[model samples]
Target: MPESATLPSATTKLEYLRKDLEDLRYYLDEFSAFLPLSVIIVNPQGFILDINQAFENLIGLEKAGVLGSTVAKLFCEQEQFAELEARVLKGEVIKGARATLLLRDRQISRSLYLSPRHDCEKNIIGYFLGIYDISENVKLTEGRNGTVCARTIELEEKSEDLLRSRAALMNILEDVAEEQKKVEQERDKTLAIIKNLADGILIFDPHNVLTLINPQAKEMMQLDESSVVGKMAAALTKVTNIMPLINFLGRNIKKVYRKQLELKSDKVLEISAFPFLTGRETLGKMVILHDITREKAIETMKTEFVSVAAHQLRTPLTTVKWSLHLLLHGNLGAITAEQRDLLMRTDEHNERLIGLVNYLLDVARIEQGRFVLRNKNVDFIKLAETVIAPFLEVSKNKQLNFKFIKPREKVLPVNVDEEKMVLVIENLVDNAVNYTPPHGNVTVSLSFDKAKSEVLFTVKDTGIGIPEDNKQRIFTKFYRAENAAMASTSGSGLGLFITKNIIEGHGGRIWFESIQSKGSTFSFTLPLK
Candidate 1:
């Protein structure tokens, strides 16, 4: 015979199983309702699938209300319920597991019996839960064992004990309920604050599943709460509006601070992420999106203003500088030593102004993405030497001990824009000399790291080092440390900012270490060609 003819198809078998299960449930329910013991049917997960009328009365809860709730919810001793379920699910039948059943307004002592239910294939599918009220049984047993007068006295004592126990249970339950209410209130307040926050907020659990997305976040991401919550981070990439943010964060939602993400041409957000930690455990991560459109607009406006103002002032400053140069050189007319001195000072001041204007123009170009690099292979040691040569006289005049330490071996050339590289080296050497006190030491060193294929340049100064609190903003544009400002009042504060951009543009890194009142070491590295 063919297999199809010999046995029922899978669909037919499924139909037969369903019919058998329905019939079994019907008979069990009818039989259990008539029995004196309370009975309930629970799935393998311990959720109530069916409850008999007797079980409903025993717990003082309606069958409609009790169905779909966990069996443990009806019991005051949840640990005992858990133990009973564990034993029964392991194919061990439980009999008379003592427990307390929580009623509508009181508690009752009960004994529970649980046995696993199996299908035709002997696979455990559910459990049969039976409860017996043991209070009446205890009373009956006490009455059977003693004389009437002695029993009467014992019964009175037992009654007093039962009343005290019930009173204590009621007090404990009331306290728990009051505490729960307080917790609920606090949770509501926290949710209210998060919901009303101007900044968007997204909270993901340790599994990277979206646990909470506040209203602002939903609106900003243009997502529906019903569709987005409970989704994993990877799944969010499918969403058009939020895809850029997800891509920027990548697969790992690490701790990032104040990084700019342009969601659209008109909308810019400063995104930050941090782990939500409790003690030593990381519970989840929270991503905050703060709108920065207005700040970016204002910054653009300031950069444009600086660029225009610098361009307009440069021509006049150059004219004055050339006129003073001619007069000081006697190209225009013969002048006395005193006139020459005044003209030279005027030329010096004019040059300083021109340098400031140039710095402003460079900053504007950097902001506008117009700063370009023209890279070529050149000896880095020679470049460093050329930049440091001009600072030697300045340091000598201040009586500062200056030194340039180069590597003993010939180093490979680095690919960089020579002009900008000169600026980088000049800025570091100048800061070291200008900040050092008279008789203080300033050292500029160069070394090659073959293992990393890079050259390290360091400038160390035994001078008034940067303050600890101000170290974080050392390379910030136009930011001068209080100590540096006190030491020299003549600086544009744009040198380091421009220097950092140049180094980073060459695919290099720059950093510094300093201790207040001790010394400072500024270092940078460039990859060798």
Candidate 2:
């Protein structure tokens, strides 16, 4: 808690004696009567100094009867009342702590603001406590059906007496009251935004009571707004069939929780719950329900189309590849040099087409969530050697320097899908050789990093680097760099996209560094264990 500055001048200060604080307290009490919300003034030690007409009516207590009483004696929840009283007396201000109250044996929900009161001398004295009722739509239900409620707000008070101070308690109260009116206006705007949202919005308190449900949420969940606000979450779950969503909220209160729930054969909901935290108190939780049924359906249809198309294309492509292989190997018959040369070139293009089809099928499987890995421990050193070995021959024909820098520790075995790992590394090496100019360097290397928990595989190339403007879209499907597209080497751009997915599936990360017209280094890390 902190102290406020003392008032430097008050005309009544010199004229009044020590009892003037009592007179000031009386003036403050008079001011509280004008306030609509229930108000109280309490001493430094938690004893009530005064109560306004609204406070008496709201709490069902006579002002005179509870004047010297403590908050614990009046409120059913002693712990919360005591804690709030203690904080205010220590010079802290507590606001918007929308706490559920068990008053007169009936539950009531309200927002609270408690501020420490200081005299003209600035020494800590009493406190001002205010309550705003939000229980207009509140009700109760308990059984297999029940509702809970909660909102948490906390504040740290000005903890020290200030040297440069000059303000009175009256001025502070006026400021707070003015601020409250502005806050209410902003809250109205927020409500309007929530009401018009496409996604369903549901707010619940710690007591499991549904505090709010936007109109969109009500329509989607088939809820009757007239009866929904006060109902318990358990009963709401029965009506909405959102058991998985409710269960997630129950377990992970501290974090923002999200889960997809299939409520029916045709409907799926992406539910996200965010905890409203103020200081150390978790005031409440806000849940958003996004309808993802249509999106899911579209994704399924796309996957099916890709799968069917790839299957149909795969058969004819394989047949052509085999025929070209037989011709190039002379398995059919001997051929002229010019004829053989044309067949070889055709075979290469056919292979590239087949590779593209394979990549499409892999992407389809990935999108359908069917890309499962059958992992095995494999020596990446030998794997790299085998994949990069062929690139050397291609580099030689282009008159370029290509090399593989194997780590000194040698036998670097990693847990991965060997076939997929080969695709990832080979694609990188192929890109390196394809882009580098004649006589330029392309180096492939492997090393252990992050305390040997991961193995890093890198492909370095001194090539026509990616343009600054186009770098961000490089990993996107069907996107090729301008320079690469202009070059003779053809590329599908899915190579890096698929490579990234493969690395991530292995619990690794892929990243790169490049400067236009200079070089690029593509690296991915795979976990050892």
TM-score for predicted model 1 compared with the true structure = 0.71
RMSD of 2: 17.7
The most accurate candidate by TM-score is 1
Residue 511 C-alpha lDDT in model 2: 91
Q: What lDDT score is found at residue 148 in candidate 2? A: 33
C-alpha RMSD for every candidate: 17.3, 17.7
TM-scores of the models, in the given order?
A: 0.71, 0.58
Collision count of model 1: 0
Tens-digit lDDT track for model 1 on 1-529? 7766988889999999999867765654455565555667777788887766777777677888887677888888888678788888889877768888788788888887676766545667667776766676577666655565676686667657544533333333333344545766999999899999999999999888888999888877778898878889899888777788889887567789999998775888999999988667788999999988899999999999999999999999999988988897779889999898888888889998998999999999999999999999998888888888888898899999999999999777889999989888888888888788899999999999999999999999998899999999999999999999887547878999999999898889999999987789999998887
Candidate 2 at 235: error in angstroms?
A: 12
Best by lDDT: 1
